[model samples]
Target: MRFRKRVLLYLVPAFVIYSAFMLIPLLMSMRVALYEYTGIGDMTFIGLDNFQRLLFESPYADRFINAITNTLEFFLYTMVFQNVTALLLALALTRGLKLTGLFRTIIFIPVTISILMIGFIWTLILNPNIGVLNQFLEVIGLEAWATAWLGNEATALPTVAVVNAWQYTGLMVMLFIAGIQSIPEDRFEAARLDGAKGWNIFRHIIFPAIIPIVGIVTIMTLMGVFNQFDLIYAMVGSTGGPNYAVDLLGTLFYRTAFGGVGGQVPQMGLGAAIATMTFFYDLYVCHRHALY
Candidate 1:
C-alpha cells in the first residue's frame, strides 16, 4: 500500500500536466470545430458549420482536400520505400560482411540530422541551376531529368517524399535489423532443413515474424506524414510551392489559423477546426491499424 501510494503520487503530476497541455487543448479544438468565427466579434455557435465550409463552401476547400490527399500519398510512398529499403539493407548487412559497423554508421548518420537540414541538403542537390543532381543528369545525357524537382507541380510532393525516405530509411533499417536479429537462428536452420531458402524463407518466416514491427513503423510513418510541415515549408516556402503541390494538413492549419506570407488574419477557430479534423483522421487511421 505504501509503494502503491508512492507510485500514484509520482504519476499524478505527470497526468495533471498531460491533461492540462494535451487533453484540454484537444477537447477545446474539437469544440472549436463546431463553431463559426467571422474574425470580428463574438464567435457564433454554428455547430458543424466550420466543417461544412471547409468541406463544401470555402474557396480554399480544394486546396485543403489536395493537401490531405498529398499527405496520404506521401505516407503511402514513404511507407513502402522506407520499409522495403530498410528490410533489404538489413538483409544485406546481416550477411556478416566486412566493414559492417562502418556501413551501419554511415547509413544512420543522416537519420540524426534535422528534417529541415535534410530538406535544405536535398534542395541543393536537386536545384535546377547548378545542382549536382541536374549536373549529373546532364553529364549522363539525361538532361530531361534535370528539371526543377521541388518547383514542379507534378513532382514536388513526390520529390519531398523521396527525400524524407532517404533521410529516415537508415533508422528503419536499424529497426528492421533488430527485428531480424530477434528471430531465433534455430528457426532459420529448421527452415533450411525443410528446403526453405532465400525469398522462400523471407516470405514465410521473416515477414510473419516482423508484422508487429511493420505495424508500429507504419503508425509512426503515418503520424509523421500527416504532421509533416517543416521540410515542405523550408523547401518551397509557405506556399507549398509550384502551386501548392506539396501542401499537407500541418501547413494548411498554419496558413489558415496563423497567417502566412499574404498576411491573412489569424482565425483561431478555423485553425482549431483544421487541427481537429487532422486529429480525427489520425485517430481513425490508428484505430483501424489497431483493429487490424
Candidate 2:
C-alpha cells in the first residue's frame, strides 16, 4: 500500500500540470460556449443558443456544415494516401535492402521539420507561375497539366491534404517499420520454407503481426486530422480561402472567435460552441475505439 501511494505521489505533479493546461481550459471553453461574448463586453448567459445558431440558424449553419464536410474529406484523403504509402514503404524497407538506414533517415527528415515551415515551403513549390512544380511541367512540355494548385477552388483542399500527407507520411512509416521488425525472424523463415513469397508472405505473416500498430496509426491519424490547424493556417489563412474550399473546424473556430480578413465581428460564444462540439466528437471517437 505504501509503494502504491508513493507511485501515486510521483504522478501527482504531472496530473496537476495536465489539469492546469488541458482539462481546465477545456472546461472553460465549454462554459464559454453557453454565453454570448465578443471578446470585449461582458459574457451574457445564452444557454444553448450558440449551439442552436451553429447547427440550425442561417449563415452559421452553412459554414459549420461546410467545415464539417471539408474536415471529413481531409481525413479520408490522409487515411487513404498517407497511411497506405507508409505501410508500403515500411514493407519495402524491412526487406533488408541496401542503404535501408539512409532511406529511412531521408524519409523521416520532413517529419522533423516544423509543420508551418513545411506548409510555407509547399506553398511556394505549388505556386502557379514561379513554382517548381509548374516550371517542371512546362519544361517537360506538359504545361497544360500545370495550373494554380492553391488558387483554384476545385483543387485547393485536395492539394492541402496531399501536402499534409506528404509531411506526416514519414512518421507513419517509422511506426510501421517498428511494428514489422517486432515480428519474430523465425516466422519469415518458416513462411519462406513453405514456399510463401511476396503477397502471400505479407498477407499471412507481416500484416497480421502489425495489426495492432495499424490500429494505433489509424486512431492517431483520426485524432490528428480532427485537430489539424497549423499546416492549414500556414498554407492558407484563417479564412481558408479560394471560396472557403479548404475551410475546416479549426479555421472555423479561429474565424469565429477572432474575426477574419475583412473586419468581421468576433463571435466568441459561437466559436466556443464549435470548439466544444469538435472536442466532444474527438472524445467520442477515441472512446469508441478504446471500447472496441
Candidate 3:
C-alpha cells in the first residue's frame, strides 16, 4: 500500500497533465474529423465523406500528393546536407583544433535563435534585389552565377530545404559532439596500441560507439522535416509559392483547415483527417527508428 502510494504520488500529476494537454486534444481532433464544422455553427455529421474526398476526390488529393512528395524530398535533402555535414563538422572539431570553442560557438549561434528568425534572416540574405549574397557574388566577379534563389521554381524548394538544414545542422553537431565525448578514452589508447591508425581507428571504435546517437539524430531530423511549417511560412508565406514548389504537409493542413488556399470554404473535417494521419505516421516512424 505504501509503495503504491509513493508511485501514485509521482505518477498522478504527470498523467493528469498529459491527459489534459495531449490526450484530450488528440481525441478532440479525431472526433472533429468525423464532423463537418467550421469555427461557426451548424456542424454536419459527415462521417467518412470528408476523408473519402480528401483521399480520392479533386483538389485535396492532388495537393496532398504533392505535399507528401515534397515532404519526402525535403527529408532526403536534409539527411544529406544537415546530418552528414554535422557529422563532418563534429569530427573535425573533435580533433583538438585551435580556437575550437570559438568555432563551435559560431556554428551553434544559429540554433540559439528562433526558426522564424532564421527564416526571416535567410530570406533577406537570399533576396534577389539588394541582397547580400547577390551583392557579394557581383563584387567577386561571379554575378553570372547569381539567380533569384527563393523566387525561382527550380531553386525554391531546394533553397528552402538547404536553409532549414543550415539552421538545424548546429543541433546535430552538438548531439554528435556529445556522443563522441562520452566515449571512453581507453578505447582510443587501446586502438593505438594495436597499431590501428586514422580511418581504421574511427571505423572500429568511434563510429560503432556513436550508433545510438546517429539513430536519435536521424529520427529527430525526420520529425523536424516532416513537421516543418513555420520556416516556409515565414520565408515565403503559406502559399508555398514559386509555383507551389515548396509545399509540405504542415502548410497543406493550414491551408485546408483555415481556408488559406485551395477553396473558399474551409474543410475542417478533411484537415482533421490529415492531421490524424500525420500523427499516426510520426508514431510509426519514431517507433521504427527507435529500434536503432
Which candidate wins on lDDT?
2
TM-score of each: 0.92, 0.96, 0.94
Candidate 2 displacement at residue 51 in angstroms: 1.0
Candidate lDDT values, in order: 0.85, 0.92, 0.89
Weakest ten-residue segment in model 2 by summed lDDT:
235-244
With a 3 Å backbone cut-off (N, CA, C), the pairs that clash in candidate 1 are none
Stretches off by above 4 angstroms in model 3 are 261-263
Model 3: residue 263 alpha-carbon error in angstroms: 7.1
Put down candidate 3 lDDT per residue, 6-53, tens digits, no spaces: 999999999999999999999999988999988578778988877787
Model 1: residues with Cα > 4 Å off, grouped in runs:
1-4, 36-42
Q: For model 2, what is the C-alpha lDDT against the true structure?
A: 0.92
Across 1-292, the per-residue lDDT of candidate 1 in tens digits comes to: 9999999999999999999999998897788767666456777787877777788875767878988888888888897778788889999998789999999999999899987888788889998997899999999999887898987899888888888888889888888888888999999999999999999999998889988888888888989999888888878877777777888888888888777787788766777888988888889988998898
Model 2 Cα lDDT, one tens digit per residue, 1-292: 9999999999999999999999999999999999999999799999999999998999999999999999999989998889999999999999899999999999989988999899889999999978999999999999998999988998899899999899889999999999999999999899999999999999999899999899889999988988888998999889886888999999999999989888999999999999999999988988988886
Q: Predictions ranked by lDDT, top down?
A: 2, 3, 1
Candidate 2 RMSD to the real structure: 1.2
Clashes of each: 0, 0, 0
| lDDT-better candidate, 2 vs 3 | 2
**253 in model 2: Cα distance from truth in Å?**
0.6
